[model samples]
Target: MGGGIQWQQNPALCNIMQEPWEEPDIPDVEAPTPRRALTCLSDEDSQKIYDSVPRTEDVFNLHRGDLELHEKLGAGNFGSVMKGVFRRGGQLIPVAVKTLKQDELPNAESELMKEARLMANLQHRNIVRMIGVCRSDMIMLVLELAPLGPLNKYLKRACGRELTMNKVIEIMFQVAEGMAYLESKNFVHRDLAARNVLLVNEQFAKISDFGMSKALGLGNEYYKAESAGKWPLKWYAPECIYYFKFDSKSDVWSYGVTLWEATSYGAKPYRGLKGCQILELIENNRRLERPDQCPPGVFDIMLRCWRHDKNDRPSFRDIVELLRKFRSKS
Candidate 1:
């Protein structure tokens, strides 16, 4: 078991400013117009979001000159991630550098800043560690490299050939532990799926992709989205889909889907269903069927997470304890 390794928490890394930040003037960058209509932020709005985050301390402020870009790791709608080497204090450290595409700069800058601010204060072994931030030609976030990549892809590639049943359970347990920490901090990871979970190794999984996360206001049990954007409907709780309300319960629902993905060796949820069809199924009280390899006890936990009432669902902490007991038995 990997339980012998103690959870590492870095208090020094928590340094985010709570004061209001003023917007800054940004020069226009010439780029090709997007083929599709994209909702982008104005200079004022983007600057306001960026300025809200205080500059990283010198220790966390990386020099762009010392960073060497390498192979392309992955690419998404807003930006692409590259595997890079950052020379810090005369040491060559491997890192993953995230950069926005020139065409997406106007729209994604604020989101990138938001991700940096959130990751700066989050210090846990199971969460992707923020190495530093670089602002040169474009904003770049330096993060700890997870060589194995996303958990979903990793699971699909291995196809359970090298993974034991206990190993899968341990992976799920680690993700729950990470989510439990996020819940304790009152931060809602709007996106929580195997695709967002990164594998550091066969046994170590870290939650990544915080661009969709939101920090709940003090005393607020849930955060309501003013606008409905793209969301993972298959992983969402009923409240999230219907009311645009999100909390730990919604995340627990996503965790259950993630667990299903792991047990089924990375099968896509609702493989042939459309968003409207999924809604209809949920309306009729239908839920995902158990994966072929899923144990009775594990599937029972999934059903608990899929409860029609959010309040009736188990919390991440509760899920952690349950998984621990199950792990002990396995």
Candidate 2:
């Protein structure tokens, strides 16, 4: 009454003369739907997994004196690996025993099973063999013992300050030869880091650990993406980083990195750089160079492996031929 009779109401200000206005309404918007949840493993699935593993009821129980544990050879995510002694011809024969941790992923168990299967089938002078495996509630692998352990580790302690040219050349040449044979069998070592290559004796370089291995086949494309991503950053190739596609060419890149590590006398490769920084360097045309002991010819091979394009890298066969030639000339 006061506004209408005595005062003028300003539109910019609150209009006292007007009745209280109802709030303007808005239509409700719903939140987005979330992705479907992953399916849990059923009892049947677990049973099937249990049934698929390798069992060794024929062998004596680990508690018995049939085989005695000697020393821990290595340790990994699953369990501690130890050297064992089994009596044969009144002498103790050495073997490697890898015990599995129950906490590991289902796929890790599957990978171990695959490794056992592959080792059972392969009988090569340069490849490590499976003596036996147990599939009880706890899993274990009895393998042909590598008394010398990883070559790089052995080389590090032996060649404390530096590496001789002959040693580097000899190791690389043997690696190339083993790789060539594996390639011929249509097998690609998905993980070929220095650790995977073991020494039977101080002189024998045997390719061990087939968990990350690929058998030649074409119908398995659906699983390739899931299967291939697990890689050691220090040894991965540009192709593996860029596109997740690793073939024999990817192995070549690892070989080059291995050579770098060997030539360095166990110095780490690209220690200062993070994974992203490493990718940046590679994209910008940078690669890890050979260590001081690397011969000029081996250095050339390292450079060749650093090619940005995967197809441009040399094959294992080519590596063997080149190494042979280099050895002959030297």
Candidate 3:
């Protein structure tokens, strides 16, 4: 089982002008409410837990004991991720605890709150499971433990000839399938970088974080007004940079960047280049090139997605079909 995480490091809010997806306007989707099953760790009293530290005058940390907090799995700006176990009904369940310092981000609470809502509603095989959240003001997203980490990291260790084309396609196919599912639901995972994608086992890839996932067509009134904030520049689509908007198409664009990263063995989608540089390049209609190892088919798909015009990008559905065909060749 996974355990406690050491401290690490941080969301952009939905642009008010952006709209959410149009649902059938049902009264509600009644699933069993999480509150009834939730175990709240008050801001106080949780400090007794070994890995737990004082967060505030009242709040203590929430984590599986350090002894159970497995080896240092990974580290990031927010904190270190550790494997842990939780005993429930006489069984020990594995969990990944993403521990972050209370001050990791200026608005960690709001970002975490937004992520909680997004992940709570998402249910897809390609997406990682959010087991629960622990907080004392400091936050820890209790997520399903992906035994294999991210494919991007795996690619780095693949020694340039690590993965077979078939295996690579299999992983990308999983990502496309997940994207297809999200598009069908009318949600866009604005951030679909390699770091955000994880693999549970060798062949199983899962999109874990929903910190960037949001609706479409709901609040365009505010977010649409031209002054929206910027996104992570490296992974953003050209249109997203210009229009300050996001949609499934924009998601396709982000995925294209992800495909590029995967193909390049987790290389920076565009290294040494800053946002302004990318904007200038896009304004001039310049785009990224494929790596030597990239499959021609995959490279073409990425190109289509990186098109300057939003409408020119392939749909996630289209990409899925193409990926499946590519996969079949193997």
144-187, model 1: which lDDT tens digit per residue?
A: 76667777777777778867667888989999999999999999
Model 3 residue 239 CA deviation (Å) reads 2.6
Candidate 2 lDDT, tens digit per residue, 4-114? 222123331123113222112212432222112211333233223223333353532333345667767767545778877655336455677777765755566776777
TM-score of each: 0.81, 0.74, 0.73
Those runs of model 2 whose alpha carbons end farther than 4 Å from true positions after fitting are 1-66, 87-91, 160-163, 218-223, 227-230, 328-330
lDDT of 3: 0.63
Measured by TM-score, how close is model 1 to the native structure?
Answer: 0.81
Which stretches of candidate 3 lie above 4 Å from their native place?
A: 1-68, 75-79, 160-162, 217-230
10-106 in candidate 3: lDDT tens per residue? Answer: 0122331122121112123332222211123331222122123222322222333422455666664456687776544444556677767456567
Models ranked on lDDT: 1, 3, 2
Candidate 3: Cα lDDT at 124 = 69
RMSDs, each prediction?
A: 15.1, 21.7, 14.4
Query: Best candidate per lDDT, number?
Result: 1
